[model samples]
Each structure stands twice: as structure tokens, then as C-alpha cells.
Target: MESRSKAHVSWCILLEITVAVLFCSNAQAAPLKITLDTYRNCIDGSILSFSVSCCPGVELDLNVTVVDFIPKRDRLSGHRIRKALQCLTGEELRTYTEKLTRAYELMRALPSSDPRSLHQQELTHCAHGTGSFVQDGLKADSNFTLDIHSSWIFLPWHRMFIYFHERILQKLLDDPTFTLHFWNFDNGLDGRTSSTEGCSEPGHFFPGIYNDNSTSTFEPSRSNRTRVLNVPIDLTFPVMFSEADPAVALRCVNEAVPRNREAMHLAMQKGRVSRDFFGIPFRYGDVRPPMLVGGGSLEYFPHNSLHDWVGGFMRTPLRATGDPVFYPAHANVDRLWDVWMKLGDGRELLQPTDPDWLDAEFLLWDENRVLRRLKVKDVLNIADLGYSYEKVYDASWIFWQNSTGLVSSAMAPTQP
Candidate 1:
């Protein structure tokens, strides 16, 4: 009764908020004109500038100014906007699979020592190894290990990693327009805007595009089959996983839709600042590994869940590259970052402006076969990197920010 009552009230609130905020005056209302440079701050408007002192020193302001989403007109160049593709249908999936296969074939043909070599690149930049932290001309203490996961560098590091990988596939295909597809498990393979459940499975569970071992792009060394027992590899984050009981599984199945939505919600809505959204804040001149800090809600939820579900080799932090799906999975993660950036009435959603974050640098192999150093601030704009994701999703996701657990609690599956 308690659960049902809560659900009933929430449903009413959802309908009211959706009607008022989403529909505005008429049923066919335009997207709220974002008042740029304006912030819809909390009543007790205050923030902690995680700059010189790390994450300390709160300032109460008369108003808040969020990290603004820069308009295209203000950009220097927009020539190479890479579209992150989605495998919504067989034809669409096949197109991406074939292109990815060809790229893999060509990249595998490159000599191992060549920076552009597929294996070499993954190991050097992504996978963990005996000498993972050692880069040319850059030295770290022998005991120091560079783990992008659990560290503040996770976001920017993977951003560059996926960008470079996309470039490799494009160059090898000899098609400047070639781009990678994203395994959008959260939105399902059909990739529609329906707020329905069961889309994450059958439709996307261990996506068929990456599961078939016969394909060059679908590696089999470590995968779903080998996933550790009792592990929630196939589960979406914030939708916690359990086993041994059909009732539990069913309950989980029921909540997947809303929790998945809510996870995206909290990652974007509650995680308003960089320290909150990206992970722990990195301080200026900070050369040590992140101690008490962990990943942000974004990284912990869908991001890590995708990696876990793509288990086997993907389960390992440093060696998941063997699985071809890693790129597409990260592409989806990257897409969400763009999605978060553009969400809200150009008001609530924001990014961090800490000098440590903006100035952070990582390395990657450029398309010219040269080892090039890239900065975190450089890849802020996908167009700047010569890529842009296909505009997907309608305004439905924007409506549920105020939906406080309407689906997760009462929707649990019960035994007959």
C-alpha cells in the first residue's frame, strides 16, 4: 500500500510537471527558450570551488553562472563533425559492422610497433601493463600506476581515446565520413524515445552486433559467456542486480526502465558541477593518484555498467580493448556527455571550470602516425575534433527530472 501510494502521488506529480513545464501553455509547446548566461540555481545558491584547495571553500552567490554551452557560430571550425551512429535496425547495424570490420582488418595489417597499429594503440593508451604509466619523455615513480578508472582523468582520457580510434577507422576506410556506432543499451538497440521497459534486453542484451564471434569486429577472448558468476555484468547501473529468485529478476526487469532514466537524470541533474559529474576534482599541480576520490555518478552508473556487461576481457580495467565493442560503448558514453551538455533550459546542466580540469593533458596517436599530446580542453567540442553525434532523442527525457522514484519502488515484480 505504501509503495502504491507513493507511485500514485508521483504519477500525478509527473503528469502535472510534464504538462506545465514540458507542454507550457498549449499541448504543442516549443522547447523552453533557454535564457543563456542565466542559471536556475537552488534556493540556497552556493558552490564549492574545487580549485587550489581541491574541493573546499564554498561561496554563496546572489546568482550562479553555469558553464555555458557555446554556440556553433562562436566556433572556429565545424568541418569534421563526426556522427556517432546507432544500430537501430539490421540494415543500420550491418552498415556499421561492415565498416568496423574493414577498419579492423586494415588496422590489424599495420606493423605492431607503428603507433597506428590497433593492438599497439590500445595497449599503450588504454590497457594496463607492466609499464603502462611510462610514456616517452614522461616518467613516473616505478610504483605509480595510471588507471583512468576511479581517477579524475577517466573522462578526458577516454574522450581522446575514442576520438583517436574513430579517426583510425575513418582514415583506414579512406572515408572521411566514417564514424563509429554506439551500443546504446540504456536507450535500447531500437533507439526510440519510448519510456517503456524490457528494451534493454532481447533488443540490446549482449548486442548481436558484438556477440557473434564469426565477425572480425566481434572478438571472443573474454566476453559475456565468461563473465564471473553472480556478477551484474548484464545489469544496468542504479538498477542494482540480484539472482536465484525469479521474483528478484522480474523486479529488476521492472525497474530497469525508470532507474536507467533516473540514473541519467541524477548524472545530469544532481551532478551539476564537474567535481560532481565527472568524478573527484583534480587540484592544480596535483601529480598524485586520486586518493579518497572516486568516479562521478555518470562514470559509476551506465559507463561502468556497459563495461561490466561487456565482460570477459572487458571486465579487466586495463585489458578490455580486445573486445571491439569498447569503442562503440565509449562512443555512447561520449554521446551522453554531449547530451548532458545540451540538456536543461540552458540553465541547470553545467560543466566544471577548474584550471586543473581544463589544463589536464593526456597522450594519443594522431592519424599521421605521430605520437601527439592532447589537452582536456581541446576535445570540449566534438566539431573541434571533426566529429558530432547524430541528433537523437526527443524532449521526453527532459520531462522526468522531477520524477522522484515513480517506477522503481512499486513496479517490483512479485511471485505469483
Candidate 2:
């Protein structure tokens, strides 16, 4: 009897040791480097949205040289003001799977009522609620909705959401540097506006990472979620008001069809000013304009179009976050803002400095799972939050399309 008890104790000890080793091995696993081959599974899993900062990538060496040319915007901007990582390339998306999966898992794991949770009922309310803080007191009424879309809340609210989302992801992954990749859908494989890479258009290419049943990044949706949506990311996908002329889509076969490169040119060139791209910084005047305060060209075209193109579960804004692409897609839009701001030596394009624009408020979950209210002014500089996107025009080779030298799309020069 004593021998039998001793043997059982030994077995239990062995099992515990095995678990410890597995945890250590997984935790200490060298950070995966972003590579073209890497994303074939999760590498290019069409993140279309976000990741953690301080994560591994090919930017280390270049950081040595370019840190000189890159102006030090702020002590903190160094961290938060990340160059929205473009999803056009597969690298960032591949390395980000662990972080992305962990974030989604944890958020979903939380109770639905928690503002951070992504459960259906809560998301449904928020969607109809538009942009709002569903806390006590102010929003006591069940039907009291805060439509934060359009005008000012658009950029600020989204930024706050992305910030909390990124922070939550960082916690789940336990890596502060984890960051999200912005879907640079407009740019092509070569980071040139004119290059024609097969299935490489922003609207085309689906990250095969998510399609594979084995990958954590994959999210099963009715619309062959894993299959790449080979069409161009069409900005003219929606007809807006049923009454509006469908013919506004210049060359599309049908109102619902995707427009060609010409449509992209119009979206960029016509709204060559700040207010046009970002919309009036503050949309809430004395009389609140109806929801959808006439989104700017940026919001109307690339932003909305990408959401529609990544259809199925993500077809509607309410359920958009259900798909991972939503993050990188918004990151791409944010990157465009950076691109636009940097044009003509940074003076040409700039967000509004009005107190209203700066003082905009939005609610998001902090790392502690507590609901935190953040002002639009607080998040303007991502670097303050501890990350920055890869250098815009001169991004590292991690985003290269080929062996020689090629930058990714959506990040191509403003000029043709």
C-alpha cells in the first residue's frame, strides 16, 4: 500500500513538471519574426485591423539609422505615434496572431455587460447606440442612445476604441509593444499607386492565415471568411440613400459593384484638404446633425468601402469588429490620415486645433477592465501611448513585396 501511494505521488509530480515546462516554453518562445513565408499560415491572415507594440519585426536595424532623420515629435509619441502598420504586406499580420487571438479570446471571455466584451447583445446595443458610454446615471434609460458617429466622434471615438483594443491586446499577450496593422488597402504590392499585382489590390488579397482551420487568427464567417475577396477594395460599394443617384459611381457595372482605380483617385484628389478627409472636427453643434454627419471622402470611400468589401459577419458597422480585418482596415484609414498630414512637409495637412476638436470625449476599457473615459485630444499622438507606425514612405523591408526593393501599397507617395 505504501509503494502504491508513492508511485501515485511521483506521477502527479511529473505531470506538474510537464505543465511548468510547457508554460515556460510557450511564454519564452522567441518572438516570431514577420516574414512573407511566415504569413502563409497566420502571416497574412488578413488582419485588416490591429496588434501589439514592442513586438518583433524587421525594423530593428533601420531604427538605428533613420532615428536620426525622423523628428522626435514627443517623448511619448515615440511609443504611441506608430506608423499604422499596413496590411498590404503579410509580415505584421503573421507575427500578430498570438496577440490578436489572445485579445479576442479574453474580450469574448468577459461577461457581455462589460463594456470591453464583444458579445452580441452588447455589441447590438452599441451599434444602434452608435457612439456612447453605456454607464450608469447619464444613460439610465434603456433607449437613450448616443450616436457618436459622423463629425468629431468619428476619428476620436474610433481612436479611443482602437487604443483600448490595442491596450487590452497588449495585456492579453503580455507584450507592451504589440500593435495593430492598418490595412493599407489602397496601395498595391509595390507601394506604388499604378502597379498591378495580381490579386494584390487593397480590395483583393485575403490573408490565407485565417482561412486555415488550424490558425488562431481565423474567424469562421458565412462569407468564406478565409477566402481572399479578390476584388478591389471598392469605396463606392454603397448607394447611400435609396433616393441618391446610383450613377454617382462613374464606371461600376451596377450600383453595388466595386469602382475602379479612377474612383480611388477622386477620393484622394478631390478632398485634398484636412476638413474634407476628416470631416468637420466637431460635428455636435447647437443642433446635432442627423447620424452619418455626411462622412468625409476618407470615411465615405476607403473606410466604409473596406468594411463592406470584408463582408459576411462584418458587413454592417455593428458587427464589423466580429471580423479581424476591421482593425487593420481602420489602421489603414488612420495611416492615411498620417500620410495626408505628412504631405508637403507636414504643413499642408493637419487635424483641427479647435477646443471642441481637442476636447471630444469617448469611453473605452482600460487594461484593468475598468471603463475609462478618454478625450479625443488625449489620443491624437499615439506615441504618447507608447508606439508608432513604421516609417511611412521609407518603411522597413519587412513590408517589401519582393527580393529587390519594393515598398507596400496604400503607403505609396501621394503623387503619381
Candidate 3:
């Protein structure tokens, strides 16, 4: 009878363990939810409702606050920018590129589920939560390229990229509550500081805090102005060259060009320029020689330079790699343009005055098409595109009447 009791006890313990395992498995199977909102305030002085859609459950009405974002500070200063560039051994450069390539692949492979699909999933699972939207053909890799030439082309490409990414979040989560906030850097008016003295403010709408040491400065200019080969190469070069191995391209940047923090710090000197393929010189600013014009110099300088400048020289054919940062940098440039528009006398600049600029067309996509051509007049008013950014200078600050007005007006407001 004692032996029979011992066997029965052992069986009971085994049954308990199985039950515990099943319970834990069920707990781990919960679905994910996301939500996104705009930065503007509502009628109650709360954050404005940009849009709020969600996946899976009951949606709650909440006010989201929009604040200025800042990048982490870097300590390196002066000639460090040039020194860093020289320090980039070919091997280091290769590794850095590889990592960017991998990031591209991962972003591209994100599941192509829209808001409706997520909502249905939520109903089926009976999960309680909200999430952001997702969209089609909205992968991040499509924008990375050192080969981009015209500032006009570069700026719009990034703007569209940011818009598409935000739209994707809205589609996936169906939460219009989700909104993207940008870093305000004009004259540091918002009191938002950057980790790198030479680094410009981050632009485009990115969710969450990102602290990647991917910024570089090559002095004489506020940022490095490297000219890349303008000649287009076979779009399939990366794929074909690697025997269609995605790993090959990723390895090139990841292991070769590890992020160079010190070098990045050194790159932000005044009067620095980077040479691209065939040795074309590029610099920052709107001045005659393109002086360093960060922290708000004037519209005629860098603002005009952005539209007038073109990438020159072609040592070799250029191919696109999948690095997400490329688009953000250009987006930063566009944001600067937005700031410049507010600084000017609220008058539109005539592009037709410059023959070369007038003939140029910016290639981009509208909401319905793949590639659409736009002119200088098409994008001048970013607000028309359904977005308005917080001014670096508040209305309480002095209003500038001209480029020089930035200083004079700040000292004393122009009374009406």
C-alpha cells in the first residue's frame, strides 16, 4: 500500500508541472499595439489632435504634448572634423557602411500589415490596446545614397520619406493620435541644445530617442560637404556584385566603418570642404563661397545655396546603399529651409531669376504616383503640405524685417 501511494504522488506532481507550462504559454501569446498623435495643442490648450488610430481595442482620447528634441552632445571640437575623415581607414569605412545596409534590410522586412488588418487581428484576439499604422511600399532603404546631387532633389526626397514613414505608422495602428516632432535648431531659439557644437538639429519625424553617433563635420563649413559621383550606375550593382547575397553588402559597411565618435567630432570646423568623385568641392552656407552658416546666418546664404548647388564630377558610377540616415540629413536641410521662410520678410523668392535653377526640376512622388516632377515653387510652402513646425523664435520674440533683422530685432522688437 505504501508503494502504491508513492507512485500516485509522483503522477500528481507531473500533472501540476504540465498545467503550469500551458498557463505560461498562453500568457506570452498577447498581441502588440501602437498609437501615434500630432504635436499641436487642442481647444483645451492640450496637444492638438494630428490623428489617432489604433490596432486591436477601445481607443482612449488623450492629449499628447509636443516638445523640441535634441541629439546627444559630442565633446570633440575644431580641426577634429578633418582629422576624423583622414582617420577613417578604408576598412573602417567599409564596416560602417555594412551596418547601415543591415539596418536597411531589417526595416524593409517589417511585416506589411495595414491598420485594418491590425484592427481585425485585435478583434479576433480580443486584446485591449492601441498601436500606430503601417503602409505598403514604405520601406526605409529606398532613400539611402551618397550619389544624390541637387540640393533641390535631396531636400524633397527626404521630406517625402518622413511623410511616408509617418503615414505608415498611422495606417498600421490606425491611431491618428501619433505625431512626429522635430528638433528646433534655428539660433537655438527653443533653448534645445545639441551634443556636437557643429551638428545641426535633427529633422523629420522620428519616434523615440535615437543616440547613434553617425554625424560628421568637415570644417570651414558647419558640416562636411563631400561631393559624391553624380553618374548613375546600374541600380542592381549592390545586389549583382554580391552574388545576390544581402549579407555581402551589409558586411561591407558594418565591419568596415564602425562609428567614429572622435572623427565625427573633428569634422565640424569652419571653412572645411569634402571632395566627391572627380574632385568637386562642396561647402555649407549661402555666401559667395558658401561659408559656415549654421545657427541662423541668413536666407541668401545657405538657403539659396541649397537650391543653387549641384553635385559635380564623376570618378566612377554611383550605386545606392540602404542607409536610413542619408534621408534625415537632407530632411534637416529642408527643415532649415522652413525656418528660413519664416525669417524672410514673408515674401516669396523668385526662382526664375536664376536661369539654371528655373530649369531644374525636383523628382519626387505624390500620394498616388511613383515619381513626380516638382519645381522650386512647388515646395516653398511646407505648411501647404499639411504640416507646420514650431518656430525657433516665439512670437513674443522680436520680429526680423530682413536677414540683418535677426540681430537688430532680437536686441529690440520692431513696434507696430
TM per candidate: 0.64, 0.59, 0.30
Q: On residues 213-279, what C-alpha lDDT tens digit does candidate 2 reach at each position?
A: 5544455662442253443344444423222445323222232222323344444543544556566
| lDDT, each prediction | 0.50, 0.44, 0.26
Off by over 4 Å in 3: 1-107, 110-161, 172-178, 185-208, 212-330, 345-376, 393-416
Ranking by TM-score: 1, 2, 3
Output the lDDT of residue 61, model 3: 22
Q: Between 1 and 2, whose TM-score is larger? A: 1
lDDT order, best first, reads 1, 2, 3
Model 3: per-residue lDDT, tens digit, 95-138? 53443333333334543232222122222111110102111112
Listed per model in order, the count of residue pairs whose N, CA or C atoms clash below 3 Å is 10, 44, 68
Candidate 1 lDDT by residue in tens digits, 366-396: 5655445456777777776656665554232
